[model samples]
Target: MSSTATKTKPSTNPKKKKKQQQKSAAKKSSAGDATGDSKQKRLATDPPLECSKSDFDSLLVDASGLADYGEASSELIDCARYGEVDAVRAILDVWSPGKSKDGDLPLESGQPARIVDAADASGSTPLHKACANKHSSTARLLLSRGADAHALNDSGNTPLHWAASAGGSDCVGLLLDHADALHSLGRGGRLDVLLKNGFGRSALTEAFASGDTATVQHVLNHDSAEEDRLIGGLDRKDASEGEADEVAEGKSEGAGEKSDDEKGIVHEFDFLRCSEEGEAVDSNERPTVLIRELVSGMKSMRGNDCQGSSASRLYIHLSFSRNPQPIKHADDPFGQAPEDDTTGLGIWCASLVMARWLASPSMVERMAGRRVRELGAGCAIPSLAAAVHGSPAEVIATDLNPETVENIRHNVELNSSTSRAAKLSAATIDWGDESTYPPDPVDYVLCSDCIYQRDIVPLLRKVVSGVLAPGGTFLYVAPDGGRDGLPAFISSMGKNGFERAGGREAPEGYRSNPLRSGDGEDCFLHFHELASTRYVLYEFRKC
Candidate 1:
């Protein structure tokens, strides 16, 4: 009986020891869960790690437990910001197939590569960081991995905007090429070349503002061609629809066909021969005589106070052949006929508007005691007009071409009688050579259609900066001939200590004037020739 009682006691003791061990194991499990919850809370509320190499290194050490997608995503963005390609690859590989909760990428599903587009604290994706830093290879890699090129940050700037602002021309090219491919796939509106940022400026505008000529030109060239394609497509569709309607109504299609024939004839006719009466002649057979006379007036800015007291008209004559003759002198840039050599033939609409603006009494008052200089003074019309109608102390018309300079001299002589208040002079001045201009800073500098070439932009800016006096005015007229480098030219102006003072559109009549025979026939014709050309008058002041 005693042996049996001892055996039962031993069995009870073993059972009690087993129960104690089980309770201890449960306590340890609870402590482990509490620790995990605290770690998660700390991670959730913590500020984003600094985007630096060191911070990224530490993050990689603990990447194994990257199940918390928020923490992992933060680390990934930092890695991208620092251009850590290896670190980016590591993070991506870990989150690749089975490791994540649903056997998919933590941030984006299906496509693991799309994780590159995940936004950080500022709503900037890894692609944005890569672009802003000019990380072209990384950008290319991300793009190849399916990063969204059109993702906008908190500032409403896409990766393209950042690339343009950074002057990352290669990155810009990549993004633009990708966007073009997308457009070809019928995703037309996904990326906008004209997309404005928080500052109400497009990527092109930002590129221009930043003085990035390469990027600006790239965007302009691409956008212009794209716009042309869209417009052409629409025109063709409309023509087809019109033809269908004509067939359905049983109307004479002969009229439409005749109109098209006439249009073709008009296009083939030399610009000099197309008369206001719509007369068409064989341009190759004979040189069509083209003559334009512009009569422009300037009024007082005093409004009702001065009435028409200050209003005055200035006349300018322009003549050229519809088919320009070959230049006899090899050095002559503008191959004008020897007989009409004094007539500055390629008169831009910007020159007309600038002349008009200078003629305004208020504008004249501002130049009352100032020395004014006009660069690339084509035909010298603006200078002559300013001399004849405005009250500048002196006016110097300068051109790079010797023939153009001689023509300007002749024009000054022609208008000398009327230019009583101001002294007008013409000189052959090369903007690239600073010695040609006066040593003393000029009070006003006028520029029109001078920045057509990208290589000359820097030279032009240098000349303007060298010649302009402190607090002086620089009046510029840029005609929109799809000049890709214009924005960069303007941006360079700001960097050279110039600020926009004011701006205004050309006179309504001048803007709408058609070159047809009418009141102010030559002026109307000149305006009409440049009607599709947009002219912007910018008034900038040196600080």
Candidate 2:
């Protein structure tokens, strides 16, 4: 038989070629599968690969009923190891920790499981895992489901203690809140507690040691009763041996000549040292040197603008300057004060704002090279100083208070290099309103003493969020009045997808000198986030 020769035709589509390749590949897999030459044949592949769920069940059990307890319960270990919340919950519901089906043995072991303070072998429970990974929502779920917030791990650290030392104040706040509700009043009306860390310390101690004042204050300010309890035993001493000895000796030499006021101030300093935790510790631990330097500098600046062109002055001031002018509309938040009068240093908001910023230098450095606009730039001292020293050209100085505007001009002259002073100007700005010549979306919005009223924060937030670039920041420094302000701010930010970064302790060298006290107490007033009293350099960036 003769075959007729025919021309072969090639498929034009690329899909044809791919199909051929896949067919050949399929043949190879089939061959391997038949000879068991795949993963099973490759012993050198270490442990054999796990079977798929369907296959594993086929070999492991009869699906109609359940697997034996020993084998079935072991699945919980894998669930926990993989952090599978659903699987763990399922296992927990089926194998609930207490008594077994026979009413004799516990679900975990033959004996009954401890109820209130149970922990896993690794010294952790579901709560620890959630907190350790900063899974806040998961932690809340666990807490609501009856996970003990006070249960200690092998290290003896309750969730609160771990949260504090770990430096996430949100966690600390959560745990402290839980502790508050559960605490029982003792026979003598004292608050009973739980949740001690390995060091035998409460969450407050950890918060204080970490220098997270917001956390400390939140934990402390939960109640007047809790506040007294947390602060009760903590000794706040100021005079270490070296400083006290010198003060004592100096007093002896000036004994008769020293004014009674001077003696009282010194004595008060001693007492303050004993009361404030920041000062109670020894020289190596206490913030004394920095405090002394600030106090000394404030003494010399007496009536002059402390934040003027001097390098040292720039280093100290942190807020926008308050100026005096027609910018002071009836709507101005800072009450009216006379313009062109430099003598009224007694209640200058600008000066107080500057003093607060001096509490943390690192925080000031972080704002460098960003578009910063001050809502109420009193004296414009801080803004001018920032423009000259750190971030320049991008600072918009504004004041709604007229006296602050005039003072701002004076301060600009006081601090600026003549060339830079010419470049800086103070203007009037009303927050929460659109500006005609709004500068490039502001990278940072700075405000000081703006939280006197609770309602003002929403306004501030609206202005900040609206004016800021996508990742812009807000640096706010307010002394105690907005008691629950930070939480509200955080909640608002969260709705906008912003979270709190760690805050820093205010610098120790800062002192409220202009607001003098005839008494010797070291006036260590603190600014707080929420209800916490901490001297902080807070930073909040846009989501």
Q: What is the TM-score of each candidate against the true structure?
A: 0.39, 0.33
| Residue 33 accuracy (lDDT) in model 1 | 30
Q: Per-residue lDDT for 415-525 in model 2, tens only?
A: 344213224666665565667336668777776544434566687777676677877777665433223465566457555656565455543333322221211112221
- Candidate 1 local Cα displacement, residue 201, angstroms: 40
Q: Residue-wise lDDT of candidate 1 within 231-342, one digit each (tens)?
A: 2221112112332334222232332332321111010002222322334323444211111221111111111112211101000111111212233332332234322222
Please give the clash total of every predicted structure, in order: 2, 36
Q: Residue 252's C-alpha lDDT in candidate 1?
A: 28
Worst ten in a row by lDDT for model 1? 8-17
Which regions of candidate 2 fall more than 4 Å away from where they truly are? 1-365, 388-391, 418-423, 480-486, 504-507, 511-534
lDDT of each: 0.53, 0.41
Per-residue error at 329 for model 1, in Å? 6.9
